[model samples]
Target chain A: MLDTYKKYFRFLVKYRGMFVLFVLMLTVLGVINAINPYFYKLFVEALPEKNYQTILNILILYVGVNLLETGIDVIVYLLGDAVILRAARDVRERVFKKIQDLDFAYHMTNSSGSLISVLKRGDLAYFGMFHELNGLYRILVHLILMLVMFGAINGQIAWLMGASFVISAIASKYLLAYNLTTRKAFNKQEDNVSAVIVDNLINYETVKYFGKEVKEQRRLSKAFVLWIKTLWGFANSFRLIDIVIGLISAAGLWVVLHRTFTLYMSDVIQFSDFILILGFVTSF
Target chain B: MLDTYKKYFRFLVKYRGMFVLFVLMLTVLGVINAINPYFYKLFVEALPEKNYQTILNILILYVGVNLLETGIDVIVYLLGDAVILRAARDVRERVFKKIQDLDFAYHMTNSSGSLISVLKRGDLAYFGMFHELNGLYRILVHLILMLVMFGAINGQIAWLMGASFVISAIASKYLLAYNLTTRKAFNKQEDNVSAVIVDNLINYETVKYFGKEVKEQRRLSKAFVLWIKTLWGFANSFRLIDIVIGLISAAGLWVVLHRTFTLYMSDVIQFSDFILILGFVTSF
Candidate 1:
């Protein structure tokens, strides 16, 4: 997997300067996502003082900051497109060239139907991998920024949030792996189904002469049964993750809300701080 | 489009009882989504009183509601899978039969590469359409519930939200249509690229005899260039929508926050109400 990622990175760096700009823009977007909630805290704090001018100014600033965030997001999206699309094109071209260069014996041995399916999926996988990793990177930045803000308010509460995130991450790793396994099984079955269709189309004359349309449909129906079963397993795994992670997060939320409420009661924090904490946890 | 949806619904109703259960559970899930935030308002209200027992009870109740939501979500996912998977299988089987039952001349004219691609995409379209419609239904439920809550507080604010939603939806409809056009163009180019590859593999013997591997590579490169162009167009269309909608929402946010802040300053509502308004808007 590391080797695969290294090759992906190699393609990514084909537009080295643009890729750097994309990363920087993404980090800015993450900062914006994290800090926007802080403005709400500002609003809540300003409300008690009847500071009309200050409140209006904060609202204006809040909207200004949001507009700026949107601007950055636009740039990030464009940069992401420029980088990922070029890299994807490079990957596809290389894959096509490599396939063309393969030994004749290899081509003869491999069914073109399955080979084409693999090629198509490989093309899609490149795009999926880039976006997934890009999203993960942004999320990491947002998480760190949020934790820092949480720690600034109250260290124990931040610790509670961090611990819960760690537990959730650990659980997600296993659950997502299981999901991937089932998904891979389903993909294989899907490929078989497609292969059946492609093969049937390729041998249409023979099938027409043999009058085996019903037989072909029966064959596809059989493939559909197993395909459906694997798909259910894949779908069920997703819900399993949802249930387990949902409960875990609920527990975390309960503990955090309780801790913050206690802090508020003891006068360790103001009501604004309480609202901010609530906003952050719920939004996250 | 109506006929298409009618066909989809016909397939969906194959598992009549499960489909009804799925829709009911989905509605329940949407209510849960909309109502959960009211508990935050309750928390804020309780904080001012320092009502320890009430706060603890609310906390417990919040967690319990979340647990129930998660439980319902699990059931919904399972039911969705049962309904959608079976419906999709039926659709696929029917499409396969229809295709097989077509004239041999039709099969002769259509490249199997593109035909299989169309079949595969059609199969996927069913699943995608189901999920997209289900999500839209949930959003509709959540939005109605939220608007009612907002209206109960301030009719003007509710009107503002409703107007913003309408504007955003209108903008999204046009932008998404353009995005779809670009996406369809890209899909066509992608099919062309794959057709080149599949045709090359099918006609390998003639290519090998002619030593035309480099020519095949050139053909694929040409297809890749066009495919990349369409993809960039599609990606840019999405960003256009994002920028427009983001700014519109920011403007809406500014107006609502200012109005709510003014109301709070005038003693028309409590700090908790301010917090609740901020919470709802930001989270939504």
Candidate 2:
């Protein structure tokens, strides 16, 4: 997997300066995503104080920031498209060329159907990796910015948020990994159903000659029974993940809200700030 | 498509009580999602006035709502999973059985790989449809609840919110359709690349006998060149969609924020309500 990723990254970097700009745009978007909520906090404070000048200034700035952020998002999306598209193309081209360079004996033993599946999945995997892998950088920037902003509000709140984030992240990763394996099972069962359909179709002439269509139907239904069981397993596993994640998020909210209550009661935070903190955490 | 959906829905209804409860859970979750933000507004008002009883009650209810939402979400997810998994299983089994019943001659011409791809994608499509289709019901409930709440606070702001939602929904639909086509093109290009690789591998001996390894590389490279151009087209079209979407969402924000500012200036709403409205719209 590392070797494959290295190969993929090499293609990403082949275009030189474009990839850097793409990364930069993602970072900018992440910062905007993180800090934009603060404007609401400002507006919340300004409105209650009846600070007309401050309110007007903040409204205008807020709209401007939103529009600017939208503009930056377009640029970031474009850069991502360019780098990822180009990289995927390069990788597919290289893979195709390498296939052409392979030994004849290796080709003879391999099934074209599976190879086609590999090729198709590989391109999609490239697309998925480019977004998810590169977005990691953006997520990190957003997270750090959020942590700092939370810390500035109150240390305890920051700790709660950070701990929640960490626990949920870890919990979801495991849950998702389990989901992935179950999904893979679904995929395999799917492939088996496909193989059955394809094999039956390919042998149509023999079946017709033997007049065994009814027998074939019975055979297919047997596959269905197994497929149903597999589907149930897959779906059940997904529900389990959802349940676990939901409970984790709920627990986090309970803890966060409890702490916010204590802090507000003790006058450690202002009403507006309390509102701001709750908004931030809930939105997060 | 309608007929297929009808069949799936029939399967979903086969287990009577679960489906109704699932829909109820989704509706409840939607209302919860919409109303949860208003708690911050309540908190803001309660804190400054030092209404300890109201503050405590609201916090308790707020935490209660969040936990209840999490619980309902789990139930809804589980029911959805069960219904969808059963429905999909029924469909796949029926399809498999039908394949077996087909005239033997009908199967002779179809290749296994293409059939396998169809079966796999069909199963995934079923999974995607179940989640997205059900989620749509939840979204509608959420949107209606939000609009009603906004209208109660301010009509013009409500109109602005409603219009943005409609326009963005339409824009996204059109944009998403175009993206689908471009994605299909990418898939086709991917298939072409796969064919080249698979063909070269299968005919490895012929090339080896002819000592045309370099010639095969050239052939593959030629395919890659076309594939690269197709990929760029696909990527460019996707970026176009993103830009259009960005612009639409930005315009929506601008209109909504402008209306919000006017409402606040006129003192048509409370300061905390202003904070609430801004937070809700922006967070949305």
> DockQ scores for all the models shown?
0.71, 0.51
State the lDDT at A152 in candidate 1.
93
For model 1 the local lDDT of residue A81 reads 87
Give the alpha carbon lDDT tens digit for every residue of A231-250 in model 1: 98899989989899998999
* Alpha-carbon TM-score of each model against the true structure: 0.95, 0.84
> Model 1: chain B TM-score vs. truth?
0.94
Location of the lowest summed lDDT over 10 successive residues in candidate 1 chain A: A275-284
Give the runs in model 2 whose Cα sits over 4 Å from its true position: A1-11, A90-119, A134-137, A180-184, A201-220, B1-21, B89-121, B169-235
lDDT of 2 by residue, B1-284 (tens): 47967876787778768888888888888888888768767876788777667777887798788778777877777877767767777777677667656654565554443455456566667878788888788778877887888888888888888898888788878777777787677666555555556556546678778988787777767767767777777777767776776677777777777677777778877777776777676666
Give lDDT per model, in order.
Answer: 0.85, 0.73
Model 1, residue B32: displacement in angstroms?
1.6
Best by TM-score: 1
Task: Give me the candidate number with maximum DockQ.
Answer: 1
